[model samples]
Target: MAINIMLATAMQPLGFLSAGWLADWAQPHTSGPGRGAALVLLASGVLLVVWGLAGLRYRPLRHLEDLVPDAAPPPEADADLDAVQNRVLAA
Candidate 1:
């Protein structure tokens, strides 16, 4: 869970950098700023489509829900509080 949080936090800046790089690359090939924006949108859409198709093609990805079991339900709030209180009293 900690690693997941760290990776998610790290990805935000990387996402911004990639978008900026894509815009720069598109700017050179297109006519104006507006055209560059359009190109970026087109490229992003293409990438999404390709990603979706790949997910569908991959068996494990396509059946992700079946591949992984659901997490156990969390302990009840009162149960957790009681356990903490008992530990404090024991200490």
Candidate 2:
């Protein structure tokens, strides 16, 4: 989640740089096609960054079973596991 946030934040600067370059290259035409393109890129970049931050809000919990912290298999299950291990070792 943190990594995603960082990446999305990174896109903002990249989008700005690209838009600046395009606007400069367009010169007088910048107010026409270049400006429109820059606006689109800027908007899209902002959306990406916002989306990444939203991911943090939806991250899953690591431990769902909070009622029992020391939960374990029954003793019978442990004994069966041991028996299986012993048979494998003997073979």
| Model number with the top lDDT | 1
Candidate 1, residues 26-84, lDDT tens digits: the string is 88888866777688888779998998898899998788889799887655544778787
Error of 1 at 91 (Å): 16
Which candidate achieves the best TM-score against the true structure?
1
Clashing pairs in 1: none
1-91: candidate 2 lDDT, tens digit per residue = 5996999798889868787666565556546655756765676689889976776565453233454466686656756787877987999
lDDT (C-alpha, whole model) for all candidates: 0.83, 0.69
What is the TM-score of each predicted model, taking all chains together? Answer: 0.58, 0.32
What pairs collide in candidate 2? none
Q: What TM-score should be assigned to candidate 2?
A: 0.32
